[model samples]
Target chain A: MYGDQGFTIFDLQLWAEGLGITFGVFLSSSILGLIFGSIIGLIRYYNIIGIGRVLMLGSEFLKNSPVLVQLFLVYFGIPALFTIDLSPVEAAIITLSGNTAAFIAVIVISSIDAIDKKQLEAARSFALSEWQILRLIIYPQSLAFAMPMFVSLAINQLQVTSLVSVIGVVDLTRVGDIINQRTFEPFIVWPIIGVTYFVLAKLVERIGARLEQRFSVHQASSEI
Target chain B: MLDPAVMMEYMPAFWDGFIVTAEVSILSIIGSFIIGLLIALLRISENKVCRFAALFYVDIFRNIPFLVLIFFAYYGLPEVGIYIDAFWTGCFTLSIAVAAYVAETIRAGIQNIDKGIIEAAKSFGFKRVQIYTKIILPIAITSSIRPLGSVFINLILTTSILSAITLGELTSASKIIASTTFRPFEVYMFLVIFYGVLTFALSAVIAGWHKYLNRYNEA
Candidate 1:
């Protein structure tokens, strides 16, 4: 029925706008997730008082549960409970960031653990403060180790951004839904949206591979 | 604001929703595994067309959001006059989506198998089908039990998304409870914890099973 309506130029603008929103949300939340997750990881690594345990428990819940539920809780539930207004985009950002943080924290913790204890001890003996050791020793190595996992997590979180459409945020998926409803062309509409995501994921994989190659060059040369 | 007391009365409805979620999750898990196994085989097939087809399926399904897939199936199936209920639609979409991940994991497991074992099987005069069924599959499944378990756990978490299409699963059930009781916070808090505990328990079982399966190989 909608196929007869003919594709309008307006649909192109809507798709572009949707792509912008989706990428905007993904980039912002990813940055927030990295920062928040690293802090949580550091706290757990240092075994900071009772707060470490609390953060770990909270992160566990965040990681284990569905992001859709988390979105609903933050978007619909929280405002009702606290009597504060939260726009759909704001709620999506908060939930996605928290969800991404949980996964990122796990990656951070494991990557730090990959470092040799003896190396840390050696650094300490060299008069390196805890902060200095973390900055000069732990950060670089852990980042190299965490790069692949972080890349994969970023891709997954990008897909998770589609769920924001369910709560009325007009992201890429929502834009597809709008066009599909009006045009009633599931065959054409969905494939275009799916291809866009596929291309974006491929781009992420390409960038990640380049970074991985660059980081491993030192080890590659040393071995030879 | 609705009274908290009124919401307490809908516990039965919420429980019913929980039951539906559990049922759909269980059914879909089994369906995905069976389908995943076949797709996994196709992915590793000697025939180039089979391999390419499987790769295409996995790539497209994996890259696309599950919500879009579900919507397509939910809407598209009816347009073609193939009517099915919400539960089946949810299960079908989940199986298709999850099979992509399962195929990837299984392909990895199959690739990791030692060449020596296959040679030995050939030397024993085992037919190609027999070798796959009797040896390759068993080895691949055992080695991949842990990864497969996580994939299934993720599938369970994904079942919550089915609520969007009116499946009345856990999240949808809680949505109704939240609205009716005007206790969105309490309802959703309970749901988050419920899903967390469910997934945690599933992962623990998986970890236990992985340990058991690899007991002889332990360091």
Candidate 2:
């Protein structure tokens, strides 16, 4: 009986709108996360001032805690504490970005460590500046090492984006919840929502594979 | 302004929620390990149908968000006349969903076992079941203790999502307390630290156990 109410042209629009919001938030938060996380990673790598220890502790807490609690803290707690206006979407962005950044910082730090110390010393002996050494020696190798971890993290973070719906951002999962409630069709609605996420994940995997291939070409050439 | 009086009043409710979280997590860890081992065996089975079925299960469960799976089990199971309470539903869904991840990890551990060991077991006239139970499973378990522990820790964190389905777990109980006391910040911040410390402590224990298990292998 509920199936009779299901297939409308407006549903397509709703799906599109939801997909747009999901991708929009995912893309923006990922970029912001990468930038912020990389900076933190670099700071830690350089052991800058006394702030790196604090940043490390902060990020460790962020990583260890569940994202749902983080979402609640951002969505409900922050506004209550600060007496400021924050929309659900804003809270979603803030929480997801922070979550993504925490993971990214870990990835960046590990990848940087993977670079050979001997190579760095050799570059220094040749009188390369710190920026030049980083650019010429560290960036390429660390990027290669970090690519796979970044890809996996990106995929995980994409799924985590679904949690944002709980805070009332009308992302794909929230859209599915809304439609399912109205139509009472959990089976159909949730499957559609789940498949959209699966496809997005697959897309990320494919792109990451391509990048890994492209970056690993240097190793291939050297071997030949 | 800080309200010590309100937090003090809600401490009992928070403690109750913490106990429920611990109970659910412990049960689901055991449940998932058993189910995951079975699925991992099925995945490595010679029968094509069994392998395909295992793959299908893992693909579907791993791709779908845990929240959606919980919703489906919580609501759809009741529709199908399989009436169960939130705690059971939470445990069941968690076991089934997390088993996929655990299965994959175990499969990796199994595959990493040296083929020479299997050959030696076969040469010694060990039956297939004996070999699996004796040589293969033990090796996989020892090597996989660390990864499996992390997976279980993640499963514990995921149990918090069960709160959405009315499971009165830590997060849900804290939500109620926070709304009642209008101390959202303190409540959630405390919840976050609570989870962090819980997981951190579990990982430390796991690391110690892992080191102890692998001590003979170390030089």
The prediction achieving the highest lDDT against the true structure is: 1
Off by over 4 Å in 1: A1-4, A218-224, B1-8
- lDDT by residue (tens digit), candidate 1, B1-219: 433454467778878988998898888888888888999999989899999999999988888889888888887788788899999999899988998998899989999999999999999999999999999999889888999999999999999999878998888988988887778877888789889998899999999998888777643
Could you give the CAPRI-style class of model 2? medium
How do all models score by TM-score?
0.95, 0.96
Candidate 1 Cα deviation (angstroms), residue B118 = 2.3
Chain B TM-score by candidate, in order shown: 0.94, 0.96
Candidate 2 structure quality by residue, lDDT tens digits, B158-199: 988888888898999999998998989888988888888888
RMSD of 2: 2.0
Per-residue lDDT, model 2, residue B64, is: 74
Off by over 4 Å in 2: A1-7, A218-224, B2-6
DockQ of 2: 0.72
On a 0 to 100 scale, what is the lDDT of residue A63 in model 1?
A: 89
